[model samples]
Target: MPAPVPTPAPVPRQRDTSPAEGGPGTGSLYGQASLTLLVIEDDPAGGLTVPEILDVDGHRIRLRSARNLTEATRLLTPDVNCVLLDLALPHGATGSGSGSGSSDPVDPLAALRQVLRIAPRHAVLVLTSEEDAERAAEAVRVGAQDFLFRDELDGRLLSRAIRYAVERKRADIAQYKLAESKLRAQENARLERGLLPHPLLEGSDLRFAARYRPGRSRALLGGDFYDTVRTPDGTVHAMIGDVCGHGPDEAALGVELRIAWRALTLAGLCGDDLLATLQEVLEVERPNEEIFATLCTVDIAPDGRRAGLCLAGHPAPLISRPGRPARLLPYEDSGPALGLLPRARWPRRQVELGGSWSLMLYTDGLIEGRIGKGKERLGQDGMVEMINRHLDSGLSGEGLLEASVTEARRLNGGELTDDVAVVLLSRSEA
Candidate 1:
């Protein structure tokens, strides 16, 4: 005895309509006025003609038929919105690629799966007999949008299923992309924090504060780097450097150089020997011979009253003491930048640091910004004047560095087109 087909849940008349097709008289600009369905069934001659199913807005749904997966592939066009695959279609007996005979009984959804593979982007609905209702539901679980029992299939029901499937697929794709974007953002942040150096000035009396800004858009790290550490002998070593470009590659090189500097310094290297070893590191790690880096390194004495200064074509450090205006350190005897000369000799000079003084070390990004829209740059002399003004206003330490960098960006009329890094070390006798 044949069992009666279970009636499907009622489908609403005014389903969400999109402008993917034309509706009744003329499709709305914002809403699809029509829909196109591709029906893949084994018997083309079988009386399976779709009845007239008009959308709520009077837009009519169009239908196309194919006897097998091969023919359906040829008719599948960009305009086809949904696919209706008949699950009863015959498959090859030997599990062959021809898909000629009845389907494999072990996997009754073989024919439906073939249709899905060919039209993966299109929404799909499986059509089966009422007796195979369980298999039809399984087809939906295998990625079909819905399933229809042959005995209860109606024009209105099919129309509603098509619209629902398409909308559901779009929502799924949007959700996937949003999640992917957030994951990428989190990974970049972790990578950046790991790459950027943290000050190693433990047990030192000098107050240290630093700031960095990348010139590249949407980037957290740049080609500017700095570090400070106190050696076993109580000599505080601080350095700031800049690579020659503005990109991730250059930023990566900057991090490498900063790390190498710390390793060598902690291992007891300083002055010309330290500078020479750093040049070797830059040469081996740089992407090309044309790549180079400017650096300024200072080793403060144990008493914090004197220091050894070495410059590799980098800007000089600024020093300001009580009862005197801020001034630029002597820079006339600096050596060529790293990776420039085969046997570059960076001469280290000794400078006296009076009691209660602040010293500023930075990269070219600090003083290279234009004074205004004009071509004139805020040269070393100009930077000296600017720092004197800030000192006159009673700003010191972090407040001083923040104000100076902000003023530089303002003078350039916008963000500087190069990476900026600033490090301030201040000693107080009071």
Candidate 2:
């Protein structure tokens, strides 16, 4: 008998399978569904005469060969996904067809760096001898996706390594993005704390408004800062400080000192004693010898009739009573800025705030603004006139501050390059 005719079973429908969905990773590894490789070798014999590579789907691969990095660079394209670079470059690896030893010992890592610059998003595999594993590892750090020992590698192993390396590189890019986002959040938080402080006035019938803008563009906070607190005598204590530099560290130190000031003021620390303790804090936290801070403090009387002012190498507070024009308190008797003069003594001078007065405390970033088109700054007198003009404009609260800053920027014809911080304390006699 000729054998029974075989009956065919019902055919099963095939499911759609894109190369990217065939495995792990972003699917990009298998998207091309190909094993195109640029094999760089300066060896006289060319590539491993018997070329072999396991593809993305567990299949063998035939490599396209290049004698040097120059040819390899020329061959690099979107379709050529991976590179197999040989560390033992022979003569003329510089695209001259000479070889590795033909001239200078061609550094494979240097070649790898060039490859990365050209093909930043491509995956690469570096081939090295067992004794050169260290150099191979370094190649990975320099942008190669993976490094392998030439002796132990096989077709299947090479394919798996390529897939893993590609996946890892993509993961690295994602992690970097996440880290960048987190850093931005941290910076904003520090800025919020440094620029805005918790108000200490509750029952006091005083109007307090403050505005702060860092010299650093797109920055939330800077070393220039201010704060206020109500002391035990029902006196409102206000202060403004400026660190020498503009950086996150300086802003952080300023915040620390501001918070410490509030705490000490509430605890009855004032004048030289308070400044001395703050200097100690600066001494401990400042990053280096060049780091320092300038400060000014004011303690208003309970009746709003008098105020004790202290200056520490910082611009003095500008005072404007109802009948008088704005003017800076005093600076001739001021001590050196904190961190500049050890055990510095800030003199406590009595100033008449009188009834219904407005006191403006600020960092040098304010007075140091430009004057007209000249390189000359606003200085102490210029700032007083500017404030007087704003006060006469009937702008108050945040509006007053915004107007002042706008004028400064307008005078400068751009944003203030240095950090600017200001606090306004206006009181009515009891």
Candidate 3:
């Protein structure tokens, strides 16, 4: 004869209201709502008995019983918030993919693992005998939310455990999501920092300063890219370009183009050859055929008194001297932008730079901002005028770039709705 089944301890006559109902530090999953439990047990002979359970709100906790893993899976619905599994339940011939077909009969946690696999989102409580304390602890370690003793089964204890397990599961999921978000944010920050240019001007006397801002909200990088490097031939090479769109794919392509430009410039490629190869790269790496890039490059001589400028459908660089007003360099003979033509030629023009001067290369975003509420845009001419005003107040280098961007934003009435990149290279005789 089988041993007599232990009945649950008597519940109090009055409603038991605990902190689980409208408690502090509890999520939406908690409170007065009734919870449904799915119990997995092979109790055909009615030996194992579970008493009626009442939640903190005095409502009867709904219970659904399944004789085995197959039946449990069939009954495992989204409405079931918790699962109660009897660890001693026999792994019958019901092939529920719990590895019951294996020859090993000693694996006591196979049924528990199967229940966990099926009800991953549900809180699980493992029921075990007092003698199987080790296995009960192992069940909890194997992802069961909590463990219960068969002889100590009580309505109050079981209800409290169920609530605790559900809360814990919700907490675990929230923590996992928070950690995932934080990790993604950190990864994006590192990627943006890596993509930004780091000018190589160790030996050169040129003072380099740059400012970049992406139009997309909360974005660190955009379709605009730039780089400045002092080559082995004592020539300081500076290049700035803007991809067509302002999306992540465009930003990535800009990074690729920037890196390629750095590699090619360091390898002694310049002028039309460099721009042509860059066009080939854009044609291949761009997301679509309609995409293109506008670029401006300048190679300063060792003496810092002369420079070579090349424009590919990009704005001409603004030159500022001590006495002369700020003005744009020659852009009338500029070639088509990269990827716009099959075989375009970007002719490099030689420009004489005075002993003390500053050259500013920029993307179109700097001059495309709307002035006030009107549809009027701060075109290239307007940008030249703005620079002259800032220079009159003795602003130069980083200050000049900052003032220029801040005033443009003010003129637009808010943040500029385009990617802006400005690079300033200055040489002084002193």
Candidate 4:
């Protein structure tokens, strides 16, 4: 008789062989998300049968059959939750292009290894004979979730093992992601600490308090920045500035500019000359031509009674004194923001700050908060009123700033949507 032609691999089972039967609570790993099992066997009519395996929920477990590893891989879709590999299948039986050539048939765990490689993300179980118990145990060590002996296999045992394997895999993946998230958070915290400013105010009687809040969610810093330092000449220099956008790139540029300002200020640069050099730094460090920064700088005399003010398109500082309502300092001859006018001249204007006074320097974020839900914003005027109320309540120093920002957030009905930075410099006449 002519040699019998080999039967083609059963058209890879495309449909779920079991009914989608399930009730509430049917799909936990114990059977919560419906499970589908793919069995790779050499004998198309192998006696292996799971006629009925219902998960906790009344849903039946789905099954797909493949004659060899090649067909098994072709049917390994996302829906196929677990795989069952029959150890008796001949290694040479793998269909063409199955890769890894043919595993050694003598090494009983060879087929198990092949399955693990093909479906690394999916769960795998090995099936063997009672006589090959030793090899089945080795298969589990080599990546199989569990092993089953042909003689001991039954509907209930296989069903529970499949659910257990799927749940275990999920737990492993979850643990990995959590660890990755924590590592990323730690790295970001270290970077933020490095970028944040530290006041350089040794040998100075002026008390300094500053508050910073970035508008971006989960961000430690934004485009707003400020710094205060007392130079050797006893001139206390304080600055507050804001870059146009609220993002990491803008925030980084702000940090660079703040550090450069500190270095130049400590080197005896001041007034319009210092600002001109800072503008140059901004031009070179900004991410694009459209980027710009609003700045306000104050140089208080050693006596703490008077100061020189310069504005680079920034808001004016608020001055509050005993027996007087808080008000914004004059902003009559302010210059354009840095990066806007190459030859910008931030004129240093003289301001009289008698013996006892509190000067509040801030970014526009302070006055731009919304007034309730209307389209109107809590502009400079509203901010002044809010401050007067807080000051009247005897709030000063850190208490004053905290209350101010909290009230701003409250009026807006939520958190302010812009980066806010406020610096308060106070001198006591007492």
Say which candidate scores most in lDDT. Answer: 3
What tens-digit string does per-residue lDDT give for candidate 1 at 114-201? 7677777777888888888888889888888888877776778877777777676666656778999899899988987888777777
Q: For candidate 4, lDDT tens digit of each residue in 265-342?
A: 999999899999999999999999999999999999999999999999999999999999999999999999999997
Residue 22, model 1: lDDT of 32
Model 4, which residues run further than 4 Å from truth? 1-12, 16-33, 38-49, 64-76, 83-150
lDDT of all the models against the reference? 0.81, 0.74, 0.84, 0.83
Error of 2 at 320 (Å): 1.5
Ranking according to lDDT, highest score first: 3, 4, 1, 2
Best-performing candidate as measured by TM-score: 3
Identify the runs in model 1 with alpha carbons over 4 angstroms from their true place: 1-162, 370-394
Q: Against the hidden reference, what TM-scores do the models get? A: 0.76, 0.60, 0.80, 0.80
Please, what are the lDDT tens digits per residue for candidate 2 over residues 65-123?
67766676666654555667776664356675453332455554666665566566666
For candidate 2, give the lDDT: 0.74
Error of 2 at 293 (Å): 1.2
- Report the Cα lDDT for residue 388, model 4: 98
Per-candidate alpha-carbon RMSD to the true structure:
6.6, 14.5, 5.7, 5.7
1 versus 3: better TM-score goes to: 3
